[model samples]
Target: MWSFSTYKDKRYWILLITAIIILVLFAVFTPDYILEKTNFVPFSMLIFIVLFWSTYHLWKYFGDKKKRNNTDDSCDL
Candidate 1:
């Protein structure tokens, strides 16, 4: 149901992609000793927070656009 066409702005996508890349780099480059010491809880949580925040903003943008379209249609009648 979701499509990139629905959201014209690419900032959210960029944020999500950047977050994923950072996560991958962290996983690949972080020393084993550091990983073991923290169990990756904090880093993973930060990534999740970024992902959720971007997704929420995207969803809100879509909802607002849809609402504006509906209002415009009603006014045209």
Candidate 2:
């Protein structure tokens, strides 16, 4: 199981680095697939959208949990 603390600290940076690596790899390895390919999905766009959606959910999940914990702590105090 993953811990919230680990995610809160590293999710954005990790996702960003992974996105950059994948994009660089795709650009170098698959230039033909990416150039003016309106009929098909662009590699960078696909990776970017996936990263954006994943990060949004991760942030929402952690933020909601943190808020709940804070509320609980305040009530206990």
Candidate 3:
């Protein structure tokens, strides 16, 4: 399972970004046959990671909006 703490760290982001750049460079420079027989697992994993990250940010935005609304309502009462 993925942990949010690791993702929240700046160091982790740097590492993840570095890896992604490397992967992209490798894919671009390498021959197509290098990953021709590769399984679908890595692609599935990449998609899953993207979805999870987006979902987390979306929920965070909603949660912050709700908190602000609640505070405003209470202040007006």
Q: Pick the candidate with the highest TM-score.
A: 3
Candidate 3 per-residue lDDT over residues 1-77, each given as its tens digit: 66777567564576567657866776778676656757754884587578656755666678779989999999884
| Candidate 2, residue 34: how far the Cα is off, in Å | 6.9
Give TM-scores for every candidate, taking all chains together and pairing residue i with residue i: 0.47, 0.47, 0.49
Per-residue lDDT, model 3, residue 15, is: 52
If both were scored by lDDT, which would come out higher, candidate 1 or candidate 2?
Answer: 1
RMSD of each: 5.7, 8.0, 10.4
Distance from true position, residue 42, model 2, in Å? Answer: 1.7
Lowest-lDDT window of 10 residues in candidate 1? 5-14
Ranking by lDDT: 1, 2, 3
Best by lDDT: 1
Candidate 3: residue 47 lDDT (0-100)? 77
lDDT of 1 by residue, 1-77 (tens): 67876366565677668777977897899788877866576877777797767776877788789989999899873
RMSD of 1: 5.7
Q: For each predicted model, how many residue pairs clash, with residues at least 3 apart or on different chains?
A: 0, 0, 0
Model 3, runs deviating above 4 Å: 1-39
